[model samples]
Target: MATSAATPHNKIIGQRELVVIVALLMSLNALAIDAMLPALGQMAAELNVQDGNRRQLVVAVYLLANGLGCLLPGSLADRFGRRPVLFVSLAAYAACSLLIAAIHSFEVLLALRGIQGVLCAGLMVVPTAIIRDQYEGDKMARLMSLVSAVFITVPVIAPSLGQGVLLFAGWRWIFILFAVVAAVTGLWVWLRLPETLHPENRQRVELPVVLRNMRTGLLNRGAIGYVLGAGLLVGAVFGYVNSAQQLLGEHFGVGEWFPLVFGGTAAMMAVSNIVNSRIVERFGARRVSHAGVLTFIVVSAAQVWAAHYRPGELAVFLPLMATNLMLLGFLGANFGSIAMQPFARIAGAASSVQTFCRMFGAAVVGLLIGQAYDGSARPFAHALLMCSVSALVLVLFSEKGRLFRRLNPPRQQQPAGPPPV
Candidate 1:
């Protein structure tokens, strides 16, 4: 419930407003991805895409570019401030959305999506930096969970929104809607959002300084380990998303009910975020997330067995997938907060590096898993199990062979990295 202080311009950014605005900002990315799900079949048909897996590149290429794009914005935000970086990125993202709507060639569409991903990178990294600016540890996790609760709602509805657009108009209208949403969000930030980066903490935007700051962020033992661990879990989700249309709509024969089915599973994730927000402070992030991860592994193993034995069974498939999404709800914010606990002084650079690691690694993992789809859930289920196992190993390394520990020791206890300014 901590509110941001009045800006120099006297705009009062209350906690509620901040959380809502931040969630909306993050939702732009989710909307872009999720709203495209129902339209993938149409898009591939119109574009003459012959390979089923290649259509997934629409999502995969954006994700890969988005990860690479994460590398620059943090250093820029650290130098220029969060508001400017976010505003410019939003403007450009909107433009890319419009450009995507107009492109006729599939190659041009993917290139535009790649550029849009790069622009949207700021949208992903900067709000996170803003959150890290205001809070840390479990409080940060709590607020992030709240933000996630709202942000996740996009996934719950965006497929339906896309389906609606497709019913009335062409699939391109989805991008037009994306443009409109981004423009509105960008204007709101330009006018109301304050400079959260303290004036003194701003660094010079130079290669040496940027590199040093990035190195500090990337080299931290705990942060890097958690970043990789969390990235794997997230990558597993991306793999599912990439193949969801095919698996749910075509293979499962859900057809037009696909949006509702996808949204239902996503709604479970939103519910999980709400529950995590409620309990995270009391239980501490590590214990809650650790339990979630272990539970996820067990569930993933069940998923593998079910998929191998009963690939066509929706009753078994839907609930297990929904449970995994719910488990991710517990893991994402907690892992991110733990990873970010050490970087109070260099929140922007650190956030950027951490985001880059997670997004880039997840993108690569998602691409591989998505392309491995063979008209069955086996690949997706196996990928989930592999990802969870790998994540557990990384988390153990990060905690020095421990699991389910409480809050990480404070910055002074860390072996490396700058203390809070």
Candidate 2:
């Protein structure tokens, strides 16, 4: 397929430019979450946070806010436009970051962090809706894969960046750094990104209409299954992220090198993302995603068993951790594509609802697992086992109780190629 002719405002910005823009916007969530990892301990100390385990709440609250944020913006973008919603959300995110920087008490910090998470939800939902507005099938997968590849780097570098700021300035500067990045990104979007949703395609924002669309989306058997499955997958990842610093630093005594170790694991995820991008076109998104989910379950189960017997060995843990992270690369992109496939006509509303389910569902699961933290790797392993089993069950239900059967059966495979953007 030839590229579409550029719009007047997009004369200099081709598909590549649009992909980068969407990727950057989507990456805000990752950067916010990952960047805070190194600063978690320091923030706890500075805010005089009483409970050692409660520090994880700083991260969990933000994710919970993000889940809540996804619901309203989808309808808003459908009514107003993607550009306006995005601009407003980014600006709000910047303001929240600044407020977070100024907070002294842990309770206030938690509230502000939740606000930031909610603001960040717009960044995640709108970009995919925008992409659906312009492209579909393999092209959408390619663009998303490319974006995932780029977005994965945020985790790779974010902890290192946070650690550097903490070492030099203070924990407060982490929020300052987030503010600066959000402002720059907001300005870029305000100037460069065009409104993809035309007036005719825009849906009315009446409460009744929004509710009908959301209800319709949820009622679709395929949509519900994929959304819940994706949520469970994300819950697994969040569970790991919430405890990673503690596992690496306190348990393993990596201490100062914790960020580097975490970053390296993140880099492996990026590598798997690249691999997924390459293979998705040839094998098809459904086949690849289903296989990946099964693989993840097996790997997670192995980790649980190993932890039970060899709780003290890094050798027993590190490889499984890397494998689990790598599997997420596969799950993240394909699950989104699969869930959206059935709802492309009402992409905005569908994206919003599915995103809300995934983020909020994950937040709830992650928070529950986090509260069970017992100052050891037990919480992490148990969480993974629970998530993997739950996700596998959801996957089965999503496929109409067909466990391990193909979601989309493979036809003759397409030639392995770069995804269309």
Candidate 3:
């Protein structure tokens, strides 16, 4: 198939609308996860869940399914086009969210949440591919950072939103809100989003063809390491989220202040991403992220000490943890853009595979961290340090022991070649 020309409608989408639309699409995933945090205890108790750690399954199960679900949409989007695929997903996602709200059985609820996760996977994969269709290199990093800056606000406010809903109605209303948001966003995309995948790039959605594209993406030296490293680091964030309610609410006895405390760290992340969007084009993604990770490791080490030495002190723990999360704002967008740099031709499949690795891996690590809760922040802090050090190691391996060296300008849709055995 030869490449198709973009429609005149594509030109009508100004950059500001594009950024907001993309950010809202991505924020759907964040909102679904974060908004449920305040309601976890009530949901668990009502559903007859006895174990505290198991309450996290409300989240962990969704995350695991979300990651696994990412495997299909990209390849399908590559074949069918981004617009149709996304529309189907958004519709199903809204329906699924409503179904989860109306269900009473725990088993049925988990199954519904799993179904919703799979539907929402397209939310994660398609918008990312849409962004890649428009930008690359440091410019791509800058755009992603801006998207992230906007998207980060959902996590910052979602818990508080959930808490407010809990005060007025049952936890089920939270899912009702999710459905409303999905419907509204879906309408916006239907009205505004043009198909981004070129006709020439459309490939057969055959099993073998999809596997081959994914295999090629995973084999790229320039991308694979960052994919893996980013997954490891992102695991730390997931861990914090999984443990946050227990850590701040019960362990530290912050009680109703959990949402405020949670929002503070997320607010810092939003600021950091805003700064990164402004600076990444000038400094290069490599230099900025390398410095960010090094700083992350240092702050994480201090976090470990604080958790142990000042174990009961909320004043000491909050600021250090906030700084660590703030650093993640620098790491996520840059690492993601660099990983996607070599996959211009297969952005859909590439995005799907990389997202699967990052999300599934992070979900499992987060589940472990959540289950490890023992009324102190030491385990969480230690996990963060371990993940950061391991991430730096993988990054070094990816760069062949180099750090802060500038990546060459973007190439044509070509492979970055295979890594050494």
Candidate 4:
């Protein structure tokens, strides 16, 4: 509900418009990954890829690059401005997409995907910085929940969008579409979005300065611990993403109906975000996310049991996978806010570090789990179960052995992080 008081007269923009733009910006990465799920088969075929599991690199590589890519943007955003950084990054993304479309070698294709992901870092880091610039505390949490609600739609539909594109055009055109969309978004950003980084707050974009700020952000145990903990929780979802196509289409026999099945599972994440947005103010983020993590552990245990003793058909697989992903919504919406909450001064750099840890860690975890795929759900289920257990351990450490307590809560000015349960 906050408004831009700096805007002239009747043209003031507020939370609603900010929510839409931020959500769209955040959606770029989700769309980039999800839309490619349906095309993994065709991409493997066209490129002469021999192994089905290796094809997962098409998703994993991009994500890995995206995480490592965050290192520079946060420092840059803090110094130059969010707008220019976004513009240049989007332009680079478009160019990389075009370059990727023409590349024939698998190695070269992966190289370009890495570069594209690096460019996509702007879209990922800047908007969260923008949100932090505008709001704080529980208000920030509530607004993020709303942004996530809208952003989740991208995953719910991206596979279908990619499938429709695949129906007529080849897989290469998918990258071409990436080029086109980035160009349009770049223009929109250039024209409408104002610079969120205030002049007085701008720091010099130098290596020493950047490192010092990054070190400051890293020193906060509350932030650092939560970043590592949440990464493990979300990493389980990334593992599923790495194998979604093979698991749903080939192993379970969903075939052309793959998008619908994928989207249905993803829709739960969106619904959870909406529900979180509704009740986060009343119940506090720590309490709800803790419950979600507990639920995730239970589901993960059931999945491991089912996969080991007797792997079920698609009917059994769908609900278990879908429910686990849904739990991620509670973690995602709150965890980011938690990590960024205490370091408002270095929001951009802090955001980058926290996000980098989560993504890089999750990418490694997902890559391992994906490589372990044996045309069965055992690897994925086992990975999730282990991750959920690890997540609990992390949650304890992050909160100093807390489980459900919300010490001081977020609405009131209180301690740095959650209290012990």
Query: How far out, in Å, is residue 75 in model 3?
Result: 0.8
True lDDT of residue 284, candidate 1: 94
The positional error of residue 58 in candidate 3, measured at the CA in angstroms, is: 0.5
lDDT of each: 0.88, 0.78, 0.87, 0.80
Pairwise lDDT winner, candidates 1 and 3: 1
Best by lDDT: 1
Off by over 4 Å in 1: 1-8, 412-421
In candidate 1, how many clashes are counted?
0
| Residue lDDT tens for model 3, 366-416 | 888888888899999999999999999988988999999997865655422
lDDT of 1 by residue, 6-40 (tens): 24475657888898899999889889899999999
What is the Å distance of residue 115 in model 3 from its true position? 1.6
On a 0 to 100 scale, what is the lDDT of residue 237 in model 4? 82
Residue-level error in angstroms, candidate 2, position 21: 1.4
> What's the C-alpha lDDT at position 164 in model 3?
97
Residue runs of model 2 more than 4 Å from their true location after superposition? 1-12, 402-421
In model 4, what are the clashing residue pairs, if there are any? 402-421
Q: How many clashes show up per model?
A: 0, 0, 0, 1
In angstroms, the error of model 1 at 100 is 1.1
Better of 1 and 2 by lDDT: 1
Tell me which residue pairs clash in candidate 3: none
